[model samples]
Target: MVSDGANNTMAFPRETVLKVASLARLQLTPEEVDLFATQLGATLDYVARLDELDVSNVEPMVHAIELTNVLRDDVLVPSLPRHDAVANAPKTDGKYFLVPAILES
Candidate 1:
């Protein structure tokens, strides 16, 4: 465990940790800030350790298991009319659905 004192042993500086938290819009306590700094530093150290591995011959893959794309051929199909689609809706602006505003200036 990393100490929350001046004589701490974290890979990242306290100020850096606080800056990251601020950018993320997180409100962290002093203790939480120290803890997160220690944890994040340890994570970075682990990633650094991984950088030393020899993977030059390995092929890049998106998943650990083999996978194949399963998709249907694109085809035009009959669909519901716009009026019928919004018939049961509580609110609609004729061509589009009406939703509550989310942001305030």
Candidate 2:
């Protein structure tokens, strides 16, 4: 939104939005950009209003499913053998199966 001159509106066209997204390495279509601009504005407005509320002692919740850790007997049971477990793994070196790195290089 930093403008090169004064008195400029931050508003942008749908095509410009698509081009900006392309520069951002995104491939959103013109229609998608229009939809996103509307949704994004609404989302930002909602978040702005959330700051007006004072939630000082509100306990953060994990899920509203109303279910806690599933209970089970504390007793342990035999599991798959170590060799059998690693039989089909693509790579196993340190007594564990190694998986591909999730992060891009």
Winning candidate number (lDDT): 1
In order, the Cα lDDT scores of the candidates are: 0.78, 0.68
Measured on C-alpha atoms, candidate 1 has an lDDT of 0.78
What lDDT tens digits, residue by residue, belong to model 1 across residues 39-91? 77767665676688899999889888877987887999889999889888899
What is the TM-score of each predicted model, taking all chains together?
0.46, 0.36
1-105, model 2: which lDDT tens digit per residue? 322323223244465677678899998866778776665545555456668878888987878886878999999999999988988888997379998898999
How many pairs collide in each candidate, listed in order? 0, 0
Query: Candidate 1, TM-score vs. the true structure?
Result: 0.46
